[model samples]
Target: MSKAHLPTPPDFLIKEFASFQPKDRQAIAIKVAKLERKVFPAIEHFNYDVELKKKNIGMVLAFKEDDTDTVVAYLVYQRMKRLVWLHKLCVLEQEREKGLGKRLIEFLRTQMEKGGCQIHLWVDSNRKPAMALYKSCGFQQIEYRPDYYGPGRAALKMELSIGE
Candidate 1:
């Protein structure tokens, strides 16, 4: 059997996942679990709605590979009182380092530019590459939570001020 070919650049779309169906939610859960294994094995399960609402959020962006029409990654965020919060983000392993994550962040920042809001994301303290990417994209470390994710995992809060 041949493996499915992923979509190429300039042919994908970013969609908002407003109401995830049972199947869609299951798929997302499985993918998130896989990612946790690689980056945050200690967190057994993640409550989607809790994360979605806790940060005063609104929408979740799903990057859909056009050719295959599959959601390869997702970014959950919220805007509150002139501040934007990126609650969670994850890219499929095959899609990493291809500039997709940066593109999503840039898109959000562009939207924030009109509103004059600052953007922030919470990254696992051990994710050095992600930290570097955020810093390279002009985000600065603003706060740290020791064992914020548990006894071993820490949370590093990074922010980018835009339209100020």
Candidate 2:
């Protein structure tokens, strides 16, 4: 059977946390926390303090649905020297398979390439969809840690070279 193609996303607004008020950032963080709880109950959620700091360089992609502003997705990464470590990329459950995650990764890649940084990320070995997404985005698996998260759990470390 042929796989169904995901539709192109509508034009959504992307903003960094610095553009939002402290309360707004907190709201986004809460949403992120809830998503993590639902999606990866075995993993530890990101601390709000660290996530807020990472948001300064990351982005929140959102839109209005039924007259209510909603954060459909967000990217959290940290820049260190010539490397960009992708800490988290979350898309609302209903928004999955619609290309928002890929768009967010591509957006970050373009921005990081301008600064000559390579992007790196790690995904749970069990998450086949996420592994495929990273691979589709040009990330190659560089390492595998059998117990990166804990016993019986593993992680795949992947990297994408943005520039020389």
Candidate 3:
């Protein structure tokens, strides 16, 4: 990835992460978990409550200011030293092609770039839309793992190194 040029999507419905109160925290987690379950198959489901409780993991959710209950998209990541591992990136089926997923990724990059030097994630090779989205954001495939998701579901390890 070129440090000199980072792709920025048009300002879309991105509500950058915010400090959530205790109640808000649980509410958001449950909401996001629900969204994940609806969008991803059971095999790919995550325990949002447990993951968000850890210190290094964080998530960014996008929703309309007027209707926060309807979560349009979310990005979950785990930070380790200078590297951030993207756990999941999901946007509602009704919300695709609107640049929400890219914005969520860009939002995460902007939030982590100061302390984090790179972002890495394993994407299911069968998921073409996801592959395209990450590639559009300058992530390059670093490795390929066959059956990482299950037999016949290959996974691609991709990375984007931030400016040094």
Q: By TM-score, how accurate is candidate 2?
A: 0.80
List residue ranges in candidate 3 displaced over 4 A: 1-13, 16-18
In the range 41-82, model 3's lDDT, one tens digit per residue, is: 998898876777788988777776567677889888998989
TM-score of every prediction relative to native? 0.70, 0.80, 0.88
How do the candidates rank by lDDT, highest first? 3, 2, 1
Predictions in order: lDDT: 0.66, 0.72, 0.81
Which pairs, if any, clash in model 2?
Answer: none
Tens digits of lDDT, candidate 1, 1-164: 11112222465555444455545755555554555456445554456546544535544444554543355665667888788888666677787887767766766666677758888888888888788878888999999999987788898999999987
CA shift at 78, candidate 3, in angstroms? 0.3
What is the alpha-carbon RMSD of candidate 2 to the true structure?
A: 6.2
Judged by whole-model lDDT over C-alpha atoms, candidate 2 comes out at: 0.72
Residues 1-164 of candidate 2: C-alpha lDDT, one tens digit per residue: 11111123665555555557777777777766666777655546777656567534555454434423577777778878798889888777887887878877877776666657788888989888889999999999999999887887799999999866
